[model samples]
Structure formats: C-alpha cells, structure tokens
Target: MARPAVRRGAALGLGMLWWWAVLRLAFAPGAGVLEAAVAAGGWGLSVLPVHCVPRAQAAGAVGPERWRGAWRAVRTTTASPLRRSDAGSGPW
Candidate 1:
C-alpha cells in the first residue's frame, strides 16, 4: 500500500487532471477546434477528459467545488383544501 503522503499526492494530481479537463471542455469554442486539439495532443492529455467527465453529455457536468457539499434540507408542509373540485382538465 502506498504511504499516506504518496496517496494524497496521487489524489491531488488526479484531481488536478480532472479539473483541467473540465475547464478545457467548458472553455472550448467549438467541437471541431476542441476535437482537433485533443486529437493532436499527447496520449495522456486525450485520455484525461474521457476518464474525467462523461462523453455522453452535450453540456458536461461542471460544478463549483463548493457544490460538492453545500446541501440544505428544507421542511415544508401544506394542507389540501377540504373541498376540492377539478375543472375537468388542467396541467398535470
């Protein structure tokens, strides 16, 4: 097993590689230009984005670091009317 320091360093390196891809795809002006650049880039460079973000997404999953754990739970309760009538049809 790698030492704690080694593992952390590896994780940091990999995370940097991930964010690099996210940034690249986000700023990319057009498909042709990005594709050409990736095709001409180093083997490792080409593989980074594929491993990082999903290829299936047209607009890739890019999120702020804070979004990682900025969750807030909300509690709301509403009482339905005792007497209710539908207008035959309405938006579901």
Candidate 2:
C-alpha cells in the first residue's frame, strides 16, 4: 500500500510535538534533562495514533551466507580471543 500520506502526517505531528516540548520547557522552570526527555518520548508515542505500526519484512528469508558475512565483519573489528597471559589485563 502507498504510505506517503501517512508518513507525511506522522512527520507533521512529530514536528508539532517537538515545538510543544520546547514551549513546555520554556514555560516550566526547573524542568531538568530527564523530564524533557520523558516529555518528548511521550509526545512522540502519542503522535503515532495507530494501534500497531506494521514492520516491513526483510527482503527474503535469512540464509547461512548472511550469518557468515555478519560473523566475519564482527570478528574483523573486535578484539582477538584473550589468552591466559591476558587474564588480568582489564580493570577489575
């Protein structure tokens, strides 16, 4: 189904919510970082308005090749296996 309109509406609602958050913080003194974050998250959740936003499926079934490729990339950048000599290398 075409969802351009739905996406646009959601974006507009989010923008309005962000504006509201700014206004709220401006008017309410002593509203700290945590309070602002909660206000923004709550507003974002309300803007969705749908019971369930359907997730787009993967292109197709995942296969062993995908798994192997993922593992290879992960192994390349990560630290190598720790030998016995390195037992106390890290901070306690």
Candidate 3:
C-alpha cells in the first residue's frame, strides 16, 4: 500500500513538473495564443499515460476484489440519475 502510494505520489510529482515545463514553454516570449494552446493540449495528452501509471499501481496493489469495489463506487458516483433509476441500483 505504501509502496504504491509512494509511486503514485512520485508520478504525480513528475506530472506537475511536466506541467510546469509546458507552462514555461507555452508562455515563453513570442509564443502566440494558438501556439500556447497547442503546446498545452499536447502536453496534457502526453501526460495522460503518466497519470495512468498511478491508477494501475493502485489497482494492482489493491487486488481484484477491492479494485472492483472501488470501481463500483466510482460508477455509482458518476452514473446518471436516469441510468441509476433504469438499473434500479448502481451498476454492478
């Protein structure tokens, strides 16, 4: 648990560093709004894989049962009210 948490923290730290770099590059003198927007978008897309590493680590650490339970909770929280009503409960 601690190990995965540490890894997740490290990944998040790295992601923040990546964001810092993107912001620096995006805001550098002579950078246009379109150019900065493109740079930020590209950086966000690239960092997505890094974000997934933490989730993967956490799921692996928790094992299937607990991960499933967590996933259920997430689904319940995110599900549309109409969908929940149609199902008569949260998604399994």
**Which one is best on TM-score?**
2
Worst 10 residues of 2 by lDDT: 52-61
Q: Which runs in model 1 stand beyond 4 Å of their true positions?
A: 30-92
Question: What is the alpha-carbon lDDT of model 2 when measured against the actual structure?
Answer: 0.71
Candidate 1 backbone collisions, by pair: none
Models ranked on TM-score = 2, 3, 1
Model 3 segments more than 4 A misplaced: 30-92
Model 1, TM vs. native: 0.31
lDDT of 3 by residue, 3-54 (tens): 9999999879767766665676666776556655655766777767654555
Selected candidate, larger TM-score, 2 vs 3: 2
Best by lDDT: 2
Model 1 lDDT per residue over 1-92, tens place: 56998989986886665666555767776535544454445445546755444534647554554455454333465766554465455455
